[model samples]
Target chain A: LQALENIQLDLEAVNIKAGKAFLRLKRKFIQMRRPFLERRDLIIRHIPGFWVKAFLNHPKISILINRRDEDIFRYLTNLQVQDLRHISMGYKMKLYFQTNPYFTNMVIVKEFQRNRSGRLVSHSTPIRWHRGQEPQARRHRNQDTNHSFFIWFSNHSLPEADRIAEIIKNDLWVNPLRYYMMGEGVVRSWASERQTLERPSCFRFWIQ
Target chain B: LQALENIQLDLEAVNIKAGKAFLRLKRKFIQMRRPFLERRDLIIRHIPGFWVKAFLNHPKISILINRRDEDIFRYLTNLQVQDLRHISMGYKMKLYFQTNPYFTNMVIVKEFQRNRSGRLVSHSTPIRWHRGQEPQARRHRNQDTNHSFFIWFSNHSLPEADRIAEIIKNDLWVNPLRYYMMGEGVVRSWASERQTLERPSCFRFWIQ
Candidate 1:
């Protein structure tokens, strides 16, 4: 009877150890899954406008580029503009960038579409001519007079990206803005200096 | 009286528009905040036990080194052994590598505390001896029998840096696994495979 009782005690001790091990493993996995869920939720909330949803939901639409690539410029510019004709049918076409050297350094290209008399009218402004310092002539030419649409090349300093993105958020778009913080070395100055804003979401498009 | 009524109506309309705009902005901000929050949470949760609060938290810990200039042989054999007394208060140290040959590639080092009495002890087995292909007999002398940790060197086919990172994640450690997925040109050979198992919280000791 004593031997049997001792055997029972050994089994109980082993079970407790196993149970503790199981709990630890389970906790680790739970911790791992949390980050992935958060990243997915972030992408959905920050995506621009109703058109983005339409594109994401469309059966025909596909993700062209998954990761950042140098070829992104050529891909966007070289793609036959005809592919965009269909986009004009249902949604107003617009682009937005904040002034940030790393995030969206240059506007690259900004195209807008207007529905006039049942026909799609398109206009595009490319931020090519002005590379380094913005010439007064380019600034005057680049000023967005038509509030309906404009592309922000957040192609400037840290403060510039924040300022432009905030200005546009207040003035035009109905979407929330995401500010990309640089991880390491930063070079080049894009926008004039300004105080860093506390909250990234506060910048809304407010037209006076 | 008619003019006064018209002005009042205009004021009311303006208020309604402003209210609607506020609501839209509020909704967008909430959505945008989700992803940032998620990413932050992920960083917090999977940050590793030895690095912060949880199991085996030590006050005096050494940071991991990014040995980019050294080869795998040099990293494992020479670098880890150098100035071992300075790493911890006599506790064997473990090295973490930031090697992934795929999407994101980074090389980093981390030091952990020791717990000899713990139920499950981790062993980083010495897997790669003579660096891919030809056998160098001298390398075999330093093989680890204790098997307390594992270091994954990036596969050259999958961009040396990125592949090394992926292999490390698949084999050892959990969350905050710095790695990149394979791109078009990158390939994984039969030899360069993953080696990891679901182990509970453990210690890594550095030995010369």
Candidate 2:
């Protein structure tokens, strides 16, 4: 039994080393993808309502957008996500919007950072809502349904917000065109219809 | 709109490059972890009932094991998973067993490979059961409840089998000690009680 315990200790040390190595590889991969992501941002800006349509097609993010939130999303010009140093350190997401009735803030930023103790610390720029135009404030605080998507920015205490951020960073940001195509009715659903679409040679690359 | 189309075409080119790069990084990461995993296997073999206990702790795998299957699991000496060439290409799992009354085979191997057109093709060694000792054959073919876990080896048509293989490869094989600890009642559940356990300095590393 003592020998078995010693072996277990040795395995744990190896596991920790493996975990650190995996993290380093992940950080390098993130850095390598940055230039392409920046190029994607430039191209996507020319396509009207690209980000909003992409958001509307996402299963989780779509459900979060209420009627008022949908209206607000029409003003969304661009969305950018950046890993702060390394992904383990944390990430920042910026949502750029044109002048709208809902909020005066041109760009709303949400940032999540891992503190020394490894607890997640989140901060978001407060949405300066024009009087009588605050979408989240209009919804009853105790209500369970129909909360605006903007509520996610302020409600950092809810663990669901963290999950939403992950979806945005990993899923929506990675392949916005897939979702946008779904919203355009080019495909029936994300998974099943992936291979069913017939497109020109130029568009075929993105279909898969 | 033509300008937007051209930009979209450019974006697709970059996206394809990014996807290829990500796959390469994932393959490299898998190779780097292989040596540590081999060491883990050697240590775990010294601990009796390690694989069986780990299987019982897994929510999906545990429910799959009927009474007869549990008995068969007791004879299991080791389980190993290996990615073939690249992860995208496919993987294989080998389950080693001591000479047991139920089957003559000392090792059972299940392999999954991607065909030229990218469809998954799976193959497994036929379990040679002693006459009337086949646990899976005894269960009513149409019955929904209490099917033996060994049935998974024969039923390649079921998509659920593919998912189970993924769990074994990615979750069970990665950290068997965590599941084994849960089986020992050292932790109430896998995720919730992860941080509650207090151990001596020598054992502290595996607790997390």
Candidate 3:
């Protein structure tokens, strides 16, 4: 029994080492991918309604946007997710908006981080909603199941907000082009589209 | 509009480059982690009923296991998943078993790989059942929702098989200890247990 416990300890030690190595590799890749992400952002900005359409095309994110949210999304100029040095530590999301009647703020930022105690905590900038212009208050009846996307800005320490951030970081931020094409009705079949986009000739080189 | 197309093309080119680099990084890390995985296998082998308990503890995997399957799992000596050079190309799963009354084969191997046409294909070693001892033939009516785990050995070109392979590769193979602990009733609160197991001091070094 004592020997068994020692074996378990050895396994745990190995797992910790593997996890650390994985994080390091991930961090290195994130740094290498930064310039490409920046270039993508620059090109995507010139395309009108790119970010809004991409958001609408996402199944999980789309359900959260109401008609009023769509109106606000039209003014969205840029969407950026910062890994905050390392993805395991936390992430920050920035949504840039043009001068709009709904809010006085030009950019809304939401951040998730671990405190000193190692508990996950989150906070976001308050949306300076213009009087009688708050999207949350003017709920669309047909979109009863949906919550106003603006409400996401004020959501702190909620699982729903965490889920949305994950989708944005893992899905939308990684390959917005897929969603953008979906929104444009260009992708009639998902499987074929995915094959064309994801499986490049370069992949064959990795096989050995 | 023509210029927009050019920009989109440029973005796709960048995405392809990023994807290639990511795969290279992933392959490198997988190679580095091989020795640790082998060491883990050595330690885990001496622990009786470890793999069976781990399988029973997994929610998605548990649902597919019947009582008769449990009997067979008792003889399970080793479970291994080979990435087949690179994860993107495909993976192979090997289940090593001790000689038991139910079957003559000592090892069962299932492989998923891309064909010349880039279509995914799969094949597995046929289970040679001892006369009148096939678990699939003897269905337990009470376990209507569950399929015999042995049925997984024969499944080919199925999305369900693909999903199970993904779970085994990504979830089970990566951190079987979590499930093993859960099976032992040592982990009551998942969130707290996850924090204790996953968050090591080495993680702090990667933050900067």
Full-model lDDT for every candidate: 0.27, 0.66, 0.67
Worst 10 residues of 1 chain B by lDDT: B54-63
Q: List the residue pairs that clash in candidate 3.
A: none
Candidate 3 chain B worst ten-residue window by lDDT: B199-208
The stretch of ten residues in a row with the least summed lDDT in candidate 3 chain A is: A199-208
What lDDT is reached at residue B167 by model 1?
20
Once fitted onto the true fold, the runs of candidate 3 whose alpha carbons sit more than 4 angstroms away are A1-25, A32-50, A53-67, A88-93, A99-140, A143-208, B1-18, B33-50, B53-69, B88-93, B99-208
Task: After the best TM-score superposition of candidate 1, give how far the Cα of residue B69 lies from its true spot, in angstroms.
Answer: 14
Each prediction's TM-score versus the true structure: 0.18, 0.51, 0.55
Candidate 3 C-alpha lDDT tens digits along A106-142: 9999887765434457888989989977655555534
Q: TM-score winner among the candidates?
A: 3
What candidate 1 gets wrong by more than 4 Å, as runs, is A1-124, A127-162, A170-208, B1-208
Residue ranges of candidate 2 with Cα displaced over 4 Å: A1-4, A51-76, A79-208, B1-50, B53-64, B88-92, B99-106, B109-137, B140-148, B151-208
DockQ of each: 0.04, 0.08, 0.08
The 10-residue segment with the lowest total lDDT in model 2 chain B = B199-208
Rank the candidate models, highest lDDT first: 3, 2, 1
